[model samples]
Target: MGRAHVSTHQSVGGRYRLVEITRRETNSVRWYADDLRTGRPCLVTRIGLPEEPDGAAHRAPARVLRTTESVARLCPGRIATVVDALDEDGSLWTVTAWIDGTPLGEVLAEQGTLNYVRAARIALELLDVLDAAHAEGITHGELSPGQVFVREGGPVVVTGYGLAGSTTAPRLTAPSYAAPEQARDERAGPAADLWALGALLYTMLEGRPPFRDRGRPEATLKGVDRLPLRTPVRAGPLARVVQGLLRKDPRERLTRQVVREVLTRVLSEDSGAVAEAVPSPRLRGGPALALRCADRRWSGRTTVLGTTLAVVTVTVAVLAATQSLPGTGSAADAPAASASAPGDRGASRPPAAPAPSPSGTADLPPGYRTYRAPEGFSLALPAGWQRLDTSRGADLAYRVTFGAEGDPRTLAVTYSTGVGSDAVAVWRDDVEPRLERSGDYERIGSIRSTTYQGREAADMEWYAEAGGSRVRTFGRGFLLGGGRGFSLRWTTPDAAWEDGASREALRTFLRTFRPAAG
Candidate 1:
């Protein structure tokens, strides 16, 4: 990367006044500038040119403006709106509307690492923009952390459009993020853009680019083309996504639709996605709106658990079952076995005081404590039990699991804002059928109508294999008005299902539970 020759308080083309250097990259610099003619703020980027003839350099301005105009129109708010592009001072300078957020690169530099959920949101945002651009036959070859701006309470804003084919150069900036084909100086295609998206995602989660900058463009490009890729440790559910997009062969890269599916699934697991949906797919009649969780209560709980994979797939299919589309609803997924140490939960909390039942007789066994969830629910959990996983869906539906290290039992609490008024029909018609598909699953008894806390509810018991171990689950689902409902699922190893400990825990959970203080 070359240092910018322009200083603060200078004017480029005598129309925009540069204020300060906002960001620097291996091949370009970004400046915060003001428009002399309009008095509005703008972002100006200056890139060092490849050794190309003047004829090619002169056309760079028109190419950048023209191509950016095409993409900005198609993506509207998702893309940076370029106001001008010009060749001057032996460099290419492009200016666009100022974004009111920090650069993705800067955010990572300061924070060091982001949890996978936040990264998933950003990844989905990037994927959506790429889907829009690729649909119009545009390729953003120069996708990098610096090209993306993350705004507060808004979607990400992507810049650096049209820079890929700006000149004979394979990539104009961020060579480390360039795809293998681009590094080899071969003609880059849409797959190259996907590779860059993977690299950007890798960098966000790992706090460093997949390929390192070797202090020279050619050397870094060489490593990108020739070196082995290190598998990411922090990607969690996103590991597959990163690998798929960063494949060496462009033709082998994941298609846009698949990437969107994986990215949206990761997003749906976040507590924040429920409040806001993935931006309506850019294309009309695109895939159904992905389930997003708006539960601010679990917003900070973003470490993706490997055990949640089963629940994520189920969450994606919940809408289909509700609509009688195909599959049925099954929240009876495997638990995150021993993922956390016992001390991680509230080991020091005193034993819960007796929860007086209508019969005037309820007491938590010793070593149990009352625990409250941010999602507006409370229950008595065995000592050392911690929240192990959470999966969310649209309309604020979510499932949270609790378990302790070395414990073969787990309690999962689910809340859904969308459901039918008849709880039995929900289990019999919409849920049980889906449970049948979860490997060696069998119903223990007929679905039974019941009552839970004065609400119409249903009970279903079943046995299924979870991670090679036979497991038993007792479930109770109850309905509230306006299509809202909640479910409590208590799972244990089938061997332990009839034991006194398992029975006592279930009774305490059901007896002491309290809904979000509504």
Candidate 2:
């Protein structure tokens, strides 16, 4: 193979520059120019093939050239200028703006983890750029930590559009951040870029790719396909959201809208911030719970306060030690015999329990609430549990504290609409397989049946490994009225619920739950 030549020339006092290149192999050369009209450096790519007997440089097909032009148009500001093929040197090169900043990969390597707030800001900024590129029917086929430029302004992408439409001979190496599909020479699209975004986000948070190892490409690819991410201890809700986006099945990953929503919450709101560094739930003897409710009829009222109330009521037993003493007052002074009677037990019912309040201080645990239907369904919660009301889709979600009052595990629930068979099938087929293949889980048990909600439901228990840590997950799913249904999951380290008492406390709550009246 012969070496390619490249030369850059800058016009006096002008930001624009010209790049001249020669292809010794093809015995052809081309001169490409970039004005840098947008006050940014431009990227130029050149592909050269060896000359044939006739010594003529190979020309890229018209279709490929058209595709390159289309990509350039799709990415405007970032790509101040693009030159697909100036001449036939058997070489094709494209130049995009030279964004100033260190690659994100370099930053991470230098700094163990990007500051949470800063990383979030960078993610949002990058997504904005990606959204623009995606809108133009172009994809950053090679999105990776190395391809991202982190400047004071924010993070910007460095590579896009050149690789996909290249007419040069196939290349073997691709950035690890590239989606499996793109690596396999499949059609690269917006989804591929999003997948890379997910990978990038994962790397920023966890300090590594979701599926990474010091291994060969085949092993790495297999890991990417089957491995579950090792959730970072420091990662907040944004990390989980990103992990979901990084799912191997592109179709199973989140859409651009979803990514935007999550990034928005993570960046703009204080609640999106990850909780203070705390011991793993496993070490603390509890599991981390992830919950969601999809039934409109359920009213989306599951929360920390509500669940806490139920837990408290069920966990604490109020016993009346009565010594038969004579009371001369009216019947109002008389202790009631029935605990279920309306007025009879009114005064005895723990002062109507102060409606589950949460201390708003950042240091204190938050409170949550559960749905109370008109049909009369209710449960008791543990005392002192705090609730968080500021998460994305907070209106559709409720979060509560688990374990002790001050510092404890967290449980969150969100409601979704338009649930149907397809959704269920996707979960059963696509999502489940990925989870199993990740090698981070051990199935405890699963139950499939129809509940009072009139929809098919499944109850499952499993353990998931996060950063070499294990957390037990217990979840239940049931279809609600209409096409909607819901999933309820509770996660804690096995130690927290290891005892029969704690286990029974959770089980009791689940057993007593009933659909609200229609």
- Evaluated with TM-score, which candidate comes out highest? 1
Report the C-alpha displacement of residue 427, candidate 2, in angstroms: 46
What overall lDDT, based on C-alpha atoms, would model 1 receive against the true structure?
0.67
Q: Summing lDDT over every window of 10 consecutive residues in candidate 1, give the lowest-scoring window.
A: 317-326
lDDT of 2 at 467: 50
Q: Which ranges of candidate 1 are over 4 A from the true structure?
A: 1-7, 270-518
lDDT of 2 by residue, 185-239 (tens): 4676777777877777777766666665322345555555555666655455565
Best by lDDT: 1
Please provide, for model 1 over 35-103, each residue's C-alpha lDDT reduced to its tens digit, 9 standing for 90 to 100: 999999999988877677566867888888888889877777778888999888667899988888778
Q: Work out the TM-score per prediction.
A: 0.53, 0.39
